[model samples]
Target: MTEQQETPPTGVSKALQKDIPQATVARLATYLRVLAVLADEAVAIVSSEELAVAAGVGSAKLRKDLSFLGPNGVRGVGYDVIKLRDRIEDVLGLSEGHRVVLVGAGHLGRALVGYGGFRRRGFAMVGLFDNDPAVIGTSVTGLIVRDVAELTDAVAALEPTIAVITVPDAAAQGVCDLLVAAGLQCVLSFSALALEAPATVEVRRVDLAVEMQLLSFERARNAESAAEEAMSAAAGALLPRVSMTTSKGAVVQP
Candidate 1:
């Protein structure tokens, strides 16, 4: 059994949800993960500084983010790990498991189906689908890949919370439209192409190429900054230093 800990009631006010910055929202997920590890370790209470360090953030920023969820931390004791974790889960809509269906069942789709992280993160993969006749009926990670033609019918039967599209770029928009028509409210697409959907639907793209490009840009910028600093240091070393008198009247070269 884990260590006994005081757990506060878990709930988030609608006002708390309102006007939360996206950056804070993103960091909440990170905090939740850190809290999960702490909870699993049976850690009862976690100080703000400790939790912040574990979550790769500063204590001030972490406290500010938690402020949106209301004051739960004790003055001297810090936060109740389980309670804080539960509250963050509620805020991010992770308290309830999200059922997911992946379309395409290609190489990437198969790889994703095999990944265990999604299931661990409360996302249930209910179905795997593809348009290819040969791909259909094949079992990938225990899920039998169904024909894309059955997508609408499957959506009605399974009632997935999110649809993951891993189809090719050319077919991405069409697949997105089909998912929208089938009444999926949330979509996670890995296609490089941009998809069009109604404002009511939430579409998130995971373009690996674009992410790589961004990393490349940062790498180049860091290299340039390093070079500029090196040049500045070299130039400063070349410049002759002026003699200065100290408060004690001793001469010093600065």
Candidate 2:
């Protein structure tokens, strides 16, 4: 009997052909951000260990992630930081600028508009919208806020693919509905409440409390490490040092 040839998995094949993992793609985007900062300082090369530390990943994991994008690093040396940065930018679909619209003109909305990271990362804020009449005429980050009544018109005019919601929990669903109606494909929400979105629309939530909890955990770990070091030092001082000479005249300390 003849054996049947095995076909490769489509998703894995496509991802491999693109030379990246879904997870690695996300991390590479983060690494690219850090690399951009280093490149601005004129730094040339960075080792996986250093890059991993900067990107908050294990060195081995970082290497594996980069490997998905093909053999990029030199043995015994390191990766060319700028080259890796550019490669990641191309792979993650950030090489070309993307248009984004902001919903809500509150503090978070204003901060998102004023954020330099999005601009640095190749995202363009083409429009800002709010329901309040006062905020509608106000200027934010050089762009005037328009009324929510103009949401559809503004999105249609700007042709934005991404929408950011910074409204209150109660208004989040309504804002999302308007964004969907405006033809937005993706959303980045800052509201504390979870929102139900259509399968076609991708929503990424940025919860403040989740980040604060992570920070609190980090502080606790650091405090524990310091306490352990202090305890070790005190214990070491209490121990008496004894030296003995063996038959070979080699001295050993106990």
Candidate 3:
């Protein structure tokens, strides 16, 4: 995958005008999602510690992430949920309501369209496309699946902010090229292969297998560490205790 340049969006605050770290940007998304849940539950204010726990991050880390957007929470009262949510939304460009076009109406694509969270999160589903004859012309979650040939035309008409590619690994690059040629500036791909695109176009790949492998590695490492600690404790328990005897002693023990 190509490295993405850290360029701030236009019209952002001076603090945000400077490039935000990619890792921090990812954490901001998590914070935004947590804040959305808080908003739905009618939470007015949440302490930094509470938000950090909810988002699975350290309190200091959460505060530092929010700092990139400038001052957020009141020191005494905690963060105002709605205010913080809006600030994160603005910084992450969610306020713009991005329109999305997804190709590959297979299982993954179908599931993605059926997801209501996308619309709730301000991502509009503009089009769905696939090359399979059986899948074409079918409706998935109110959006008709168009043929791959119609991709460029649909992209032209829909003007999607992002295109999603979930086609098979073999067809992934071809689909990516079509989307790029259709003038799409951003793409989110679920295909296993790393897609090739010009630097001007941003492509993000999500490989489920790689993620699962990472989880497996962490689990194995933790298990190994636990076993080593157990062995160390057992060895300490087996150590002989030191004993002392006095001159006239009937057996003295220490």
Candidate 4:
């Protein structure tokens, strides 16, 4: 068989493509957030220790993640906050703006549309949709909430590659199906439902209740760990240990 022709990646595909680990990819966004704070505070040259603490990671792991984008750090002097931030943004494809549409103009959807971070982080909210007639034609965050019935047309007109589904669990799957059919390759769903999509599409579920439960679990674990440590310390102190030798290596008991 003759060698098959290699198709070139489209601009958007190129932006989305990266060889980094999913873990690193997740951390990169967090790092970018930390970096943005540093930049805003006019702080230059952040040490690995400082950056890692801010990003909730180890300094060594942070360095490794940065290395995936090639060498962007200066030895000894740490990383230049602004330059590193730019590099990270480019790697995460935040350097280019992404057109995003919100489906399910309920409370969750409305809140997300009003969130300025979406625009600040390079995601442009192009449209909002809902199936409820009461919400349709209503203005939200300066944009009118269109009926979900218009999703197909909106997708054709707006060409959104990303969609956010904040519909209820009962409606999430259908909304997701519509989104995928309408050619949205990436989706973020706030519903509690487990969404199924084609292999070509990516679906991320963000259940607020689940997240809150996870937070509660973590807090409980932390509290238990702290209590265990305190108990151990108290037990150790009460053991009545005999004092030994000092710097002179002489044996003594107190």
- TM per candidate comes to 0.85, 0.76, 0.85, 0.80
Candidate 4 per-residue lDDT, tens place, 19-106, comes to: 6778787888888888888888999989998998877677888888777666567788899998888777777767777999999887
Cα RMSDs, all models: 10.4, 10.4, 12.3, 10.5
Worst 10 residues of 1 by lDDT: 245-254
Error of 4 at 182 (Å): 1.3
Top-lDDT candidate index: 1
For each of the candidates, give the backbone clash count.
0, 0, 0, 0
Model 4, TM vs. native: 0.80
Q: Give a tens-digit lDDT track for model 1, residues 29-110.
A: 8888889889989999999999988877778888888988876799879999998988888888888989999999988998
Predicted candidate 2 versus true structure: per-residue lDDT over 1-254, tens digit per residue: 02332433232323554545466667777788779989999989999888888877778877877766554779879989888887777666666778999988999899989999899888999999899987889999899998888888878788997899998899999999888877888999998988888899999998988867866765676677567667878887544324421222211110
- Ranking of all candidate structures by their TM-score, best first: 3, 1, 4, 2
The local lDDT score (0 to 100) that residue 105 gets in candidate 2 is 93
Looking at model 3, which ten-residue stretch has the lowest summed lDDT? 245-254
Model 4 weakest 10-residue run by lDDT:
245-254
User: Distance (Å) between predicted and true CA of 192, model 4?
Assistant: 1.1
The residue pairs found clashing in candidate 2 are none
What are the lDDT scores of the predictions, listed in order?
A: 0.83, 0.78, 0.83, 0.79
